[model samples]
Target: MWRRRTLPAVVALLGVSGLGLITVGVTADPARPPRPPVDAPTRTHPAPDLAPLPRAAPVRVQIPAIGVRAEVVPVGADAAGVLEVPPLDRPTLAGWYRHGVSPGETGNAVVVGHVDSPAGPAVFFDLGRLRAGQEIQITRADARVTTFTVDGVRSYPKEHFPTTLVYGPSDIAGLRLITCGGRFDAGTGNYVDNIVVFATRTA
Candidate 1:
């Protein structure tokens, strides 16, 4: 969980999340999706212009503590800020959360990853094992890499996610990870809990 005694200078960042888990369906639901948390931070840069990252496949993902080393890819969002996840063709591995908040200027940045897919597993399968003070490295489009340190991990019921804690405000550069968890509700086809990991930029 993230705690900010006060808000600090913000920075460039975005939120990533998978949609609520669901059972394989023979039909589609027509209702609009839920609104993202209103407290999410927003990026103010003009050049990126909310453009999509090149479709180039990711080369690697690094976590110094739990031995996570995998490739990643760029996911985009609609006007609402809800982002897309991995496997553009498959719904299981995809995650999107635009309203949660961006890493406003120079504080904690939030991104959500997926745990598994109906086909098998996904990017954040081991997220539950992450601890405080670990390292996270992301290689960006320019080939420049960014590093962050894990502070802690927390799980919350989706219905009771800590809006203030996840998107409220912060005084330092950080990261928050989210994925589905808890009892599987076969009825609605969703997890009751959301795993959240807090990370901080180190370099």
Candidate 2:
């Protein structure tokens, strides 16, 4: 979904794939640790000391291959762990990852946006269509655009989300872009799966 952060992950609060649905509080205990991915790599990173995100107006998101561009909004979390989503300010960016890591930082940079809103199409609705080697760029307040490349994309059932793969500590710079996918359930009103894209930074 072109986002990575704890608040953004809160998007899952909307619900998950029908059969795989497992809300953090309702179905599963939030205290329970998320399952790690199989054959997941070990954390060899010395732990990158990170530079804080610039404070100012929010930034813009751009994907050259898809011809998609929009301004990103910063959101935080509530007492329940659900992140905030931005109001439709003209195809603008919304949502936050209040708990988890931010993009371009250490660990998994999680970003999530609406697949679609009732009123109109939302940003990241077409993110699932991105292919490997595609690039995603973000322009921060410094007026500098950071470039990222998609390395791979995978979908997982909600019941069996790879917690480690999605949230585990990393040894290098990494990313995980997530969104609902698979058959849209008519009853639950959410997708039957989540699409996660693994990416790395280029510059």
Candidate 3:
């Protein structure tokens, strides 16, 4: 039977299989505080009056500020009920939670990628560098390009990861880009924080 575990625990479990390379330490710091949260603003510009897509899956995601352009793959929960991430081997790929709303739909669409891999920096390596007003573009299977403007970027301790806020329902189309960031815990082999970019659809 599947068991419920904190996101960090699940990440640690996955780390055992090398996926933790996303948060593994490149440099060590033992003086890091036990609870650290990086919170970004939640302000957004007015959205354009564009018609929403009719349930088509996203094909690609592009973030110009960070130079990330990659194919999007659908992912679901694993046998243990933990959310599955993209394979470590294909570090350039991004995964969209299959159970969530599609990018152009009227809800929160989540896309997650690794900040780095064992080989080096990955697709979302610079995700935390994104600033408010940055653009995030997603191409749908129907050939429509949906654009989202960054509202803010925040990093929260994994233990206090705001699952509901990140995955919550939205009246308008929204997008969330997630990756590991903040201080790396060499002892645990995982990042102490999760960097989240909140954006709202503009076109």
Candidate 4:
């Protein structure tokens, strides 16, 4: 569970801003087919001998391919026990799971951001465009820059989110970038799918 203070702050900001519920998904669109479950086998870096770094808080994340460069903010579960996201007002800022292992550590590090806000497409709007073998960089407080190589990208319905597969512990440093995707459902005011990018630390 996360501290309670942030929830009220988020609610206060969102209530005044009129930003609707920010859950992941895309409404029905004629051009694109419905999103399919991603069952791609996980791929690791060839250099398994490399060691992970000591735990350190992540300050920022950069993905050159999709032009994502955002500040990292710590977040935990909200009052409803759901993972909290960065405020819609600050869509460009990504939220890191404070309870999870930090990026570059020997475990899965989760980062989440909004796909869009009422104003326009947000920081992670282009996250689904990333392909395997692309690079993701994390700048840490210790001044060490860790680079991760994308293993694969997956999209799953919110109803059947793969909790274990995404949040499971790993022997090597791993990273997961999550955002909204698929067709939007205006009636529900939510997207129909979640886009997840998996990567392993390379340096």
Candidate 5:
């Protein structure tokens, strides 16, 4: 079980300050995703701006570039309003925020997974290695596949996590894959940073 704590920044993102936070408890040092090198070349492409699809829960996520194809389970906030995560024992599963827009919808759909577990690197362990132009395919409960193109990958410290940018409403359908990264803080038993992949729906 992950040790729960109040993510004040998250609460702020929800416009409900001090209400609740999200899960933040990684026990051991796992492999962290590489940060984007400042000198690395970047690509620029016109927004695909695909029309949003009807609401449908995401059941699976596949990233061929990173060799990720994991089951996605819905996760909602607890009674105290704290956002929940996938079962700690099920590190290969990804957790989708049920309250938010589903993938292919006209909003930011957020998904999170464990970078690694006690056993070894888990789902999303190679999230940082993904580059622009790659594709992410999400299978929705409606039996439709929603495709998204990688826009960018970024890493941020937990303290300065961009809650709004990751979870905020948007005109275009967007996807954010989040996982813990950076140095593990022995004091808190948590990763010091978060790796976020920003992608926009293409089909």
Candidate 6:
């Protein structure tokens, strides 16, 4: 398991791993310049915030900006309170933090995925490429689709991940998408940082 982000530390969202799976050679592009540290407010509203939708588990997620369309599976924290990632072998699936509010609801809903696997780039490999004004669509079990407008994308060193800001309570419907990034550590078989995308329900 990766460094534990216990329930207490992150409040309701539980754990998140900067290292999703052990990769063979895929890593962050060393040539790409690093992004400035993220200091944005906890919630961002590009358009008027949409009212909270009824409780409905997300079934699918589509990020057209990065061409990511994947099945969404509910995953809870393990006994050690570490947030669980999708099985390494199933790299195309994204794991939703089932314990938190569902997408389009009134609080933060989180989804996590691997940037890569032993085979190659995974579902969220291009997550870091997303930018503000882009949109993320989540299809729920109730057949309702909630669209969110990207507020920002930030890469944080694992050690400095803002637990409350990323996973904390929100006044309006919010969404968080997470994956690993930064330099790859050959010794640890993980990345040195995490990429987080923040958005608010726009429709």
Off by over 4 Å in 3: 1-39
Q: What tens digits encode model 4's per-residue C-alpha lDDT throughout 12-117?
A: 3322121224543334332322232356736845636667788888999999997888999997765544667888778788988787789988888988888787
lDDT tens digits by residue: candidate 6, 60-80: 999998889999999876665
Residue range 48-125, candidate 1, lDDT tens digits: 112222322233457666555655544554344333455523533423232233332344445555555554445665
- What's the C-alpha lDDT at position 202 in model 4? 86
TM-score of 4: 0.81
Clashing residue pairs found in predicted model 4? 25-191, 25-192, 26-182, 26-183, 26-184, 26-191, 26-192, 27-183, 27-184, 27-185
**lDDT measured at residue 90 in model 4 versus the true structure, 0 to 100:** 80
lDDT of 5 by residue, 1-203 (tens): 22223344333433221111222345555555566433332334566747779999999999999899999999866655555678767889998888778998898898888777777787887888889989999999999998988888887766666677777668989898887777766666666677778888888
Query: Which one wins on lDDT?
Result: 6
lDDT of 6: 0.75
- Global lDDT of each model? 0.48, 0.54, 0.73, 0.73, 0.74, 0.75
For 79-189, candidate 2 gives per-residue lDDT tens digits of 554444555343346343435555555556666565544444456656666777778886666676656677766667766666667767775556666555565555555
Error of 5 at 35 (Å): 2.8
* Regions of model 5 farther than 4 Å from truth: 1-28, 38-43
Clashing pairs in 3: none
Worst 10 residues of 4 by lDDT: 11-20
How many pairs collide in each candidate, listed in order? 20, 16, 0, 10, 1, 0
> Alpha carbon lDDT of residue 58, candidate 4?
90
Clashing pairs in 5: 7-21
Q: What's model 6's TM-score? A: 0.84
